[model samples]
Every structure is written in structure tokens, then in C-alpha cells.
Target: MKLVLACTAVVLLLSAVELARPMRRRKNSIAQIYRAANITPVPEQILQVNFGGIKVTPGLEVAPEDAVDLPTIGFDFIPGCYYTFLAYNSNYSISFLSPSIVGLYVNLNGDMLADSSAIATWLGPSPSPGTGINRYILNVYKQSGLIDTTDEQLLSYQIDRLRFPIDDFVATYGLSGPVAGTFFLSQYPVFASEDCL
Candidate 1:
């Protein structure tokens, strides 16, 4: 009986050792890489703003001839952070400048209804007004390949449902009083390969 108990203890110890071996190796490999590469974590930034009473700028192509000017009543976002905008009782639009690809998602009321990879193209020349805004909710992200502009089919998919989030955005922004009647977005180039106008 004593011999059997001793053998059982030894077996348990060996099993435990085997199970820990892989974890130990992984830890050591991670440590060696960290030391060799001298990696550092980047801090993230968040941006939020509230604009009241903005005007709509009319152009030959985009806005209506008699469109009224609007104000930005409520705005908040951190460029690199995961962010979402909600609006109510209003339409929303956004335009991306050179090199920055914009992925659009829209939720009607409180329900998510649409997501697209391409809302508009701003590659070669800037639009007539040089900026874009809509009276709607606009969610922005800074990840690559989130909006694919290379394929025609995919681009159509994005544009077709691009206006999904307008209502919720208007409500949220309008709660603070009447909004500027337009939600404007301005984007700049992140790389030399990208150019706007």
C-alpha cells in the first residue's frame, strides 16, 4: 500500500511537470522577443465635441440648391478608438479625404440595418466643396482593409446602404438643442501614396 501511494504521487508530479513545459517555453520565447525587439505599447487618443447650429454648404453636385445651413450640436470621437455616433430626426453624411478609407455602418432607430465598405470615393480629386457631412450617425474606424475600394461589386455594396445611420445620429446630436442641421467630417491623408484634390 505504501509503495502504491508513493508511485501515484510520482505519476501526478510528472504529469504536472509535462503540462507546465509548454507554458514555460511560451513565456521564455515571449520574454526573449520582447528583450530583443524592445517593443512598446502605444497610447490611444479619444476625441469628442459638440457643435450647435451649423450651415449646409451647397455645391453643383452634392447638396440641394435650396438646402439650409446646419450646426453640429453634439460630436465626440477618438480617432483611433472604437467609436460610434448616434443621431435622431435628422440625416447625416460624411466624406473621407485622401488615403483614409472610410467604412460606414448605419443603425435605424436602435436597430442595426446596414454596413458598407465604400460610401464614396475620394482618391484623385476632392469633391466640389472639399468636405463631406450628412445629417446622420457616422461610425469611424482606423483599421486597414476595413473598406475595400479595389473591387467594384464591393464598392456598390457600401454605397447602397451608406445612409443607414442618419436618424439615430440626428436624435443624439439634436438632444442638446437644434444641431447645425449638418454633420460635417473632414479627413486628411495619412500617407504620401494618398492624395485628396
Candidate 2:
């Protein structure tokens, strides 16, 4: 009888250990992708980015113009904590940062674009042909205070929206916790007929 009880306890312990393995592996896998992309060292809190009928997910392939409109960025809001939202193409030109939107709330009344001013006017994604899949990442950063920077400061290379100093910008403004992030892959159709374009 004692042997039977001991065997049962060992079986339960082994099962519990096995169950934990998958969770740990999944967390590590997610973080590794972020690190591999040089986007961040840790896994970001997931957020929803919906473009019309399509929803953005990590590494999901999407058509170019299908992602033309601004996605609806949704995430849980911390009370009184200001936020900064930005999106960039990590694959193209290193980092093609769109305008940064600052000082937003869960309820921005009606128009999110109107409620929040984009330091640089918002530009939609337009990956040039043959660029392959461009990873478009959108991150919502929790700001400690209102960001004190302008469009020029954010995009120093005014000639084109490339080589954005995202790391420097984050450090300079003391921005932390990209609280939430979501990304999708896009590329222009290289072989499509003229009508398709």
C-alpha cells in the first residue's frame, strides 16, 4: 500500500514538471524572435492591430495595400499613464519610422488621428517591389511624461524616412515598457500585371 501511494505521488510530480516545460519554451521562443529581429531584447505585451478585416499577428504575411489604412491599435490602458504609439518597417531601410503619436487615452473621443497629433504626418506602408517581406512593427510605449521632441528630432534624416534612431530616441526621452506590440509582414507584388498594381 505504501509503495502504491509513493508511485502515484511521483507520477503527479512528473506530470506537473512536463506541463511547465511548454510554457517556458514558448516564452523563450517569443523573446528570441524579438531579439533576432533586433527589435527588443524581451517579449512585448501583445496588442491587437486590425486593418479592416485582417488582424496583425507576429510574422503573418499580408498584402501591401491591404495594410494601407492605419490599423486600429487596441490594448489595456493604465489609468493616468500617457502613451506613445509608433510603427516602423524594421526590414526596409533599417527602420522606416512613421510619425510618432503622443499623449493618447483609451477613449480618444471619436477620431484617434484627430485626438492625437502626429509629430510627423502619418505615412502608410509602401514597401518597394522585390523587397521581399518587410516586417512592420507597431509598438505602444507607456510614457512617464509628455515626449519633448519634434518631427525633425525624431527623424533627423529628413531626406528620407530611414535609419530612424529608435534606440537613441527611447533613451533620450526616458521611454520604457513598449507595453504592447504587434507586427505583420508585407511586400509589394513584384510580378503582378499592370492592372494589379
- Compute each candidate's TM-score over C-alphas: 0.23, 0.67
Question: What local lDDT score does residue 118 receive in model 1, on the 0 to 100 scale?
Answer: 22
Please give, for residues 1-197, the per-residue lDDT of candidate 2 as tens digits.
99999999999999999999988886677677777666663535666777789987777888876776666777776765667666777667333443223112221222254455455444656676666777777777667676644545654433345655667757766667677776777777676678987
Model 2 stretches astray by more than 4 angstroms:
1-29, 32-39, 93-114, 149-160, 191-197
Instruction: Assess each prediction's global lDDT (C-alpha) against the native.
Output: 0.31, 0.64
Give lDDT tens digits, candidate 1, residues 107-157.
112112132222332221122343343222223222222233465643453
Give me the displacement of residue 100 in model 1, in angstroms: 12
Mark the 10 consecutive residues where model 1 has the least summed lDDT. Answer: 39-48
